[model samples]
Target chain A: MIDPLSIFLLLLSASTPILFAALGELIVERAGVLNLGVEGMMITGALAGFAVAYVSGSPFLGFAAAATGGAAVSLLFAVLTQFLLANQVASGLALTLFGLGLAALFGKPFEGVKAPPMIPGPFRINWIVWLGLVMVPLIWWFLNRSRGGLILRGVGENHDAAHALGYNVRLVRIGAIAFGGAMAGIGGAFISIATVLQWTEGMTAGAGWIALAIVVFSNWTATGVLVGAWLFGGVTVLQLRLQAAGVKVPVQLLSMAPYLATIIVLVLISARQKFSRRAGGAAPGSLGQNFHALR
Target chain B: MIQLVPRSEVSTLWQFLTPVLAVLATMVAGGLLFWVMGYDPVAAIKTIFWDPLFGMASSYSRPQLLVKAAPLILIASGLAIGFRAGIWNIGAEGQYIIGAICGAAVALAAYPSEGMWIFPAMVVAGAAGGWAWGMIPATLRNWFGASEILVSLMLVYVAQRVAAWMAFGPMKNPEGFGFPGSRNLQQYPSASNPELIAGTGTHWGVVAAAVAVLATWFLMSRHIRGFHIRTAGLAPRAARFAGVKPETLVAFCLGLSGALAGMAGLFEVAGPAGQITDKIGVGYGFTAIIVAFLGRLHPVGILLAGLLLALTYIGGELAQLMLNLPAATVQVFQGMMLFFLLGFDLLTRFKIQRRVVA
Candidate 1:
């Protein structure tokens, strides 16, 4: 009695946010910068987008505000990790905490307020959904076929080599991080504006973290990111379907499916990478390491 | 042009001074934040930093400090060990929840039994539950080469869901007219963790926190395992050459931190909270991370940082009551403190120099 088309559509909607965030993280990682503040940026975007859309009566303006908000918060991470030479992990964590707090403070008024109506695009899906679908190929083209993408990969593979070649490492990473932030913000806005249609505290939940896992699951590849997001989205939609079908399992247990699935995927990917050793798509050589220019 | 130059050795003086500087910086930033939010910055700062310890309500708030600080210190002390060795167990919040559930289940099962063995059994169950939960990430990281940070954080959400399920279903208080919570553990004398003194909020948890600090200090400074942990964090290759098994260290740090976090949760449920509820997670686990960093991952430093953060919690609440400041203000303050700390931490290992432009 299960409808495949409806489930597929739901899966697409559920996966779009993760797709956007993961793609952004993929670019950042490709540039050898691991900005773990995607969650923070996403939440900030969610609130900013919701608030702006609610006040302005335009979802486009909301999405714009979300991207700006996400980028602005990410710039804080750039300042800390890129400029100040702080630990990437710690700085990213702090960014998340700061973003969460800031969003909560800003979102107090937006609580229970309905989000503005979304403009239906092709197939009656929101434009952002279509935009997300388009971005996969676009990002793939950018990372694989573009000159900027080559430089980003070169930097990630070996910052020293890139720096030796007179490339500005920090500038490239800052740009990637900002783009990642903007994408994460848009992803977060998708949740508030297109999906949930209302603002709430901590609404992004673990979607950002899931996106982080998806990047690793994707082995830093754009196509792999799409697959991973779909897999996770499938799990999310399936779990909801199971609940709707009056399964014997508790709803709480069903809710844990996506997170548990992410962990399982991560473990499998890591184990495979460990055993394969000379696998083509290994993590970036200089990922999570701060680059410093010696005088 | 100003530039940062890496030093051969970290300055001992800056190591201690950066935390103080960060605290001061947070105050200024937080004051400005309050000002922007349409409140008197001076009054808000005073309420947040001063009122909890020395204001008119000092007598009441003094004890509350220990109550607030006990879990933070306990959890942070454990977290500091793992952080020292670079084994990030960010899922202590999950461990804390499981520990509380396990401990509460023990007490709930022994409801009418007036025996000394019940509390001890609960404590053991709490620690064991946390250890078991911690092992998931440890084992995954060890065997599968997974990232503990993501795995542990993922578990937190899982634990939260499990806690919610318990509150709404199996653990719901049967005698409370369909309410979603376990029996009030505080009223159950045989299972309660009561304040040892009349006015002070001293309890078994506070004693345990103090003991943990001493124990961690001794381990980090005097023990070989602790030496291995520090060496592994500082020089992984050297530690491996010296026969320090990375797997063992990862397991030990995660397990120890998990146990401590669990004990903190158990103590909280038995003493202050008095019952297992869906909202049992008040973010002490996350806050403890900030405490661990603020204390420079040192036991003694963590103790002081715990007290300072606890002061903020109490003061934040006071501000909320008096000035109607949003509850999220304290979270922002804490986050700002960590941000400033990480930023200022640069001075410990590097010196900023103004370069001559030719």
Candidate 2:
């Protein structure tokens, strides 16, 4: 008795958080930085957004705070890697750990608090959900057609060359990181403020990691990211529907399908890149490497 | 304007000094956080760092340090090796869970038997299970060119679900009136990992951690293979020239670390935890990454870092009991410590210079 339109809408809403996050990370990667703290940014956003929404009774304000909070936290990572010249991978991991702990510490009081109801957009979908949908084309345009995106790609492909061309590599990367953080924050807030409408500890529950996997699966394309998000969203919806329909499989085992699917897709994509000669890898050249303007 | 000039030679003194500096910085930063949270920052810091070893309940908390530190040290020891080799096996939590499940399966199968062989069999099974789980990512990376970091991390989620399934389904204890957990290994005298010395918390895991530290120290300092690992990490092209096979090193590092993590899990299930439950993967796998880095990826350093982190855990608990602080206080401290350590490590690698604005 599940209607197709309703299911489609459900999938859109379900995929919104990951969509925002992957899009943000896509930009960051294009700028030659790998911030593995997506999960951290997200959780921080979830708590901050929820707390704001509860206190102010405004979901929009909640989302704004989430974005600011996420960017603020990401600045910590920017300072560490961009200024201190710490290892990008380790700093990113540290950022995640730090963000998670900071969120939990402050989030204790917000436990059991309900978020204000989110106002729906034109067709009854939440406004944030619509924003996520619109961002796909917006990001695709920015990455492929914009002059600024070309410069970002140049920086990612070769920082030294970009620096020679008189671009501020560090500033570009920090901007990208901040944007990624804001997007991840909005995505995280969507979970607590829109979907669940309640704050809980560790409620993001690996969505941040799932978003990371989606980015990889997308082959760094905005459209590919859309497809990847939908695929994951489809799996999540289908699994929950099966559980509701009294499927014979154990609930715990069934819940594992999304994660397992992520692994399998990772293997397939990686294998394709390995086996195919024509597939020029789209991974940004300076991805995950720290930039230093050495004279 | 400022600039950083790479030091011709790494500063050995700064290497030794940064960790101490990092800890002090974290204490200061953490104190600010506590102050912002409206808590008595000084007292909270004292409860976490000072009161654990010398306070009124020091006798009880002191023994608990070994118990808490054992798994961290054991897991970090193996992880540090892989890290040094630049092989990130971040899925130790998954390995830990699978190891416990396999080890418990062996014990669960031989229920009601008095044979001593069961305990040893569990250990072997645990290591094998972890090794097998770890090999999945290794194989994928070798064959398909996948990022091990992503693959290993993804496996952690899958492992958590599997653990939940085991707890509610096959591993549920029949005698416990439908409780979603297995037979208590503590009550099963032959299977339990009891303290070796009374009131000292000297369990087999603690002994294994000590052994791991020593073994790794010897390997990193004395073995040729260790040289190969370091070379591979620093200069992969040079490592290849030196006859070091990248595939082999990847497999070895991941496998060995996975096995060690599994053993840690086995010891915990048979000792501290007492049964298999859905909540078994308690962020130890992730925390050990910090321990590895904080220890400067050195075995002896990991030992000290492990104890320090475990102290935070015990202290965090004491703070909760005594000061009504949230349980997450310890986690926040841990995160802050890592942040400070990474930030401070810059002093050892480069010379900060004032750019002469011409």
Candidate 3:
């Protein structure tokens, strides 16, 4: 049987990639523009980070490359939805398809190749896990305490009002979108560099969508994102542990727990979103609505 | 020196030309991508577009077009309806898996029993599975304003694992030597959906795809419900004011899409695939999204668009076998189609003009 402490640590590590992506998307949603391309971005980051790490023999360089790759794809989204007034949802979806395709094509050459050795970490916990723990509080501070954070919340609450106040909604949004993409990239890199430790086609395998749900499961708060990631991580991590323990429950049924948890969490959050008009925890006012200023 | 004049009517020619131009643009951009990948761009493009009908390998790959297109058209046609209504059902993949699971479950339960009712019962169960899976988001969204897109999508992973479990567990063929998968449905005569036209690759699913197109066309063009769907999508406030109950519309759109998607899964399991396993839902749910978008969400467009996308699948395989190109290039090509389509679609809503400084 696996040690409980190691299993707990393993779950924390597994949760990091999803945590990074969810937190990033949370910030983006907070700014009123929904980017559904996090899956594409994550995959792109996975490939980019993996490739750079392989070539340069530096995991840090890989992370940087992943961020660049994610941001680059996000730039297309920013231009369309922010500048061209395209529908945020559609543009984001298109970006995902495009990114997935690009990654697949790019990844073909790297198929069967192994990633470099992982960057060593403190106490059997890697750098990403430590950073992910730090990022949760850091993101909390950035969103709630900082001036830029206030502006971001303002835009999400009311883009037109934010614009009327000369907050440069487009510029702030572009920055937020890029930041979100970079974070998603880091989350993706965690998979390639730290977890799976190899470049496989479609390796991220629905992690991006899980991250997206984490934002909702977290109730759109940075702290909630960490808890949701860890919560999901615990469920997923538990499944693997159950499989190892040779539990009689079919691994298939065991696997259902994590997704079931996600659905349950979503149900709870949705129930709140439904009833909360009376209780008042609303999605940011301008979420999923594109802003077109004719100034 | 250009004279400043009032903008006249937008030409009808632009509308017809835009979608075509986007397709052509995807091809050109796709060729550039091929070039970057160090493959012969022209040859790659030829395989994707020209090979299905006129290329040297046409005779061999021609039939697979129908085989591949059948499921895509079936799924995309359903997805297009919800997409048109702005319901955002992204979990068709999950629906597909659950439908297969339900259908396969019915078959597994009736193993070694030869009955006429068994197959039909499986079909009904398949649809129920899909409908139930789709209702997760539909009910959630209708009751509580959750994003259906995320909920629907998250379920795909869950469905996949469930599929893996079933294939490796109780659903496994009892008599067979402990292999993960159950008895191949292909070997079972009563449950199998065989090719009606033999080499033409025409199966029950293809007929279903045809039926879907006709039904969708009739529904969208001649039905009052369809008008409500369009109105709700284009102008939600106007739709609500027009007395089109928003919740009902959401439920109907999701339910309809789910049923059609479910039927597609049933047909696929009984036909070309011939079995339900972890590999059953092979990106069709997601790929169908591209088909829906590529076809501009029109049933007729989907018919032609489905074949076109199917051509890429066939050609992608050919490219892989003949030219050593990766299988993923076709997806890249598909992605380019959306990029070009959205970029071209910009013309429908806006036009650019230059302002000269005095």
Candidate 1 global lDDT: 0.93
Over B1-358, each residue of candidate 1 has an lDDT whose tens digit, in order, gives 7878899999999999999999999999999999998999999999989998899888999999999999999999999999888899989999999999999999999997889999998999999988888989999999988999999999999999989999888988999898889899999999999999889999989998999999999999999999999999999999999999999999999999999999988999999999999999899999999999999999999999999999999999999999999999989999999999999999998988998777
lDDT-wise, the better of 1 and 3 is 1
Candidate 2 lDDT tens digits, A1-295: 8899999998988888899988999999889898889999999999899999999999999999999999999999999999998888888888888888888888988887778887699999889988998999999999899999999899998999999999999999999999999999999999999999898888887788888878888989999899998998899899989999999999998898888888888889988877887442578889988888887
Worst lDDT 10-window in candidate 1 chain B: B349-358
Model 3 Cα displacement at B306 (Å)? 1.0
Decoy 1 TM-score against native: 0.99
Give the C-alpha miss distance for residue B127 in model 1, angstroms.
0.8
Candidate 3 residue-wise lDDT at B282: 82
For every candidate, give the share of true A-B contacts it also has. 0.82, 0.72, 0.64
Global lDDT for candidate 3?
0.84
Residue B239 Cα positional deviation in candidate 2, in Å, after optimal superposition: 0.8
Which lDDT tens digits does candidate 2 get at residues B1-358? 7889989988999988999999999889888888888889999999999998999999999989999999999999999999898899989999999999999999999998968898899989988988888888999888887888888888888889889999999999999898898999999988999999999988989999999999999999899989999889888899999899899998999999999999989999999999999998888888899899999999999999999999999999999999899988888888888888899999999999899877
Q: Score the docking of each candidate (DockQ).
A: 0.88, 0.79, 0.58
- What is the lDDT of every predicted structure here? 0.93, 0.90, 0.84
How do the residues A191-223 of candidate 3 rate in per-residue lDDT, one tens digit apiece? 998788888888887788888888877878998
- Pairs of colliding residues, candidate 2: none
Ranking by DockQ: 1, 2, 3
For model 2, the interface Cα RMSD in angstroms equals 1.0
